[model samples]
Target: MTPEDRFPGPEHPDSGPRHQPDLDVLPYGTYYEPEPAGYAEAAYGSETYSGYGGARYLEQHWPATGQAHNVHDQQAAHPGYEPTLPDRPSPVHQGDDPPTIELGPPLAEPVPAYPYPAPGPDEPVGPLYVVGDVHGYLEELRAELRHQGLIDADGHWAAGRSRIWFLGDFTDRGPDGIGVIDLVMQLAAEAAAAGGYCRALMGNHELLFLGAARYGDEPVQSTAGTASFLAAWRLNGGQQHDLDRLEAHHISWLSRLPAIALEDGHLLLHSDTTAYLEYGESIPDVNDAVHDLLADEGVDEWWDCFRRFTKRFAFRGDAGPQAVHELLDAYGGSRVVHGHSPIPYLTGTVHADDGAPPHIPGPYIYADDLAVAMDGGVTMEGRLLVARLPI
Candidate 1:
């Protein structure tokens, strides 16, 4: 099928408001410009897809796959200049307050009971639960949540009055990413309704999926001036089924998701990179910066923002503490809880026995109490993690 035939159009009942394009459909990257300010405002102002009843939205906005100009092309176009480093702003003089961001209005009023499942009368309330990266694998995700008593036998949420934070990467690389996202969206709504809340951070995959859906075959001249979303998606494991489910509304919701959130005293982010410091001084500012980038559809700078945000493994060894320190100093959190880097890699298990695949069963505490690597490599033969937080 042709690209047009493959993508079709929005499938969700709630497509929300639509807009006319200034230019006609062009091959990806034909009209490269900075995204307009109105783009962000329009994209984020819609109803969120999170909540138990919003599975349709999840299915409609799933990730897509394809090949475009390759990253090698990006490098070839750039020659010697590095494209990964972020553009830096002029250094501010000392004594200036590192930028401050006003956290948005309280998400919603807390409910009386937990939305998913109330804890047993005799069971102690779990401190807080943080799940690792669930790259699809809905069955594994369900099993892990059930193992933690976060859900019941019926596959419904059951953790009442307890908070749960998903470290992101809910989709991609495995079957049923859409299902996993749908469940999380629903649990977030249910938890909020129940006085507790279920929250997630944005992973690079989320950004990739959002870009592929919004831009599709539309090419954006990368910093290298030749790369496009089509190329990026293929490198990143974009799936055809995900593209079939893409919708404008889902893109809007994913674009608005926060890049980082602090729970209790733990800092939660999708990747271990300290590049968040480049956006703003605090968590809120960083998130806003990310949202601002997602909203600007035309600007090549938006792609640059995404490219920088996608870098991972920044917190592996010597740089790990420094990276954690930057976030801790800015976000006022004691520990940085993150996904993106799988636990097996973080724990140095990449070269396990020949037949035994790397296994990261649940949330992993790392960095000598400074960081937590949550991606359990569920996309592999490992387990999906759902653990009590504040451990």
Candidate 2:
């Protein structure tokens, strides 16, 4: 029979169209890449047979297809044509018939589900307060919440009928990152139960935290080229305690937090960056687009998205009002309230001491009053501000 009959398919007519080389033809003593010896079996096999010897025995018993058998030495065979490792011996069929073994007990019966009741329309909306970046200053956050009557002296939800929105950066560069997150989570639960709600926006620090948690020491491309998230986290003042306390719930929540929020003709966002214009026209659409990207993208792509979002100082100079006007025109908002750029930085204040109270100059209203900066630089010993809207 011609080689075409044996291999089959389209091949160059010259030299009988070089046949695909079979892996079995490789030398038996070919370089044996050192695996963990029994790593495969431990990963793929059951508890009963998962070690080195068991894996070796399994490979010997169920020889891979096109594997070269050494007539003299059985262990020195070349696994040429085999693309996969050997299978384990099954109890059912030991001889000619391929043995089949059940993997596990049948899945438990499906639990009955309760139908979700639809929410009523326009269910008594409350005044929304969008907070700026906290950066781990728990005491400042507490003071601000108290100032806004959102929380009481005992650090409990004080405003029984209002909503509070945190625009992210709850951790890093200051004390009590964990404490801040814990407080927010507790308040969110309490507020939801009490007919009020607490929501948050996603900031770049959150993306950094997520990357560090997932990639660990793996190198990822940043503005500084190939830098590991772990290194970046350390450089950005990520606490070891905070890293250890991070859970899937935190990551998922951070990832799902909206990039933009709209309230009473006001556009609420974390960063003062114009990169948001690349997403969509409407606030909801931009949020959805960002969420979709964070959900579907890999580490590199997500990091790039975060890097772009982290670009602040957009509403700082002469071009500031122009940028605010662009957002206002697109999203139908009269003003933009953002956080990433701290108020103290806008006012050019330097912190004297760790415990010294922050000096926030009357809310640092800028961009011709089109953009409001609320960060107050609490992380830098500045005041935690809570301003009434339409000022």
Using TM-score as the measure, which candidate wins? 1
> 349, model 1: CA deviation in Å?
1.8
lDDT of 1 by residue, 249-365 (tens): 556656778988887788888877776777898777888888877775463565555665565555544445666776789888898878776554445443345645553333555
lDDT of 1 at 333: 84
Give the Cα lDDT of each candidate.
0.55, 0.57
For candidate 2, the 10 contiguous residues with the lowest summed lDDT are 1-10
lDDT minimum window of 10 residues, candidate 1: 1-10
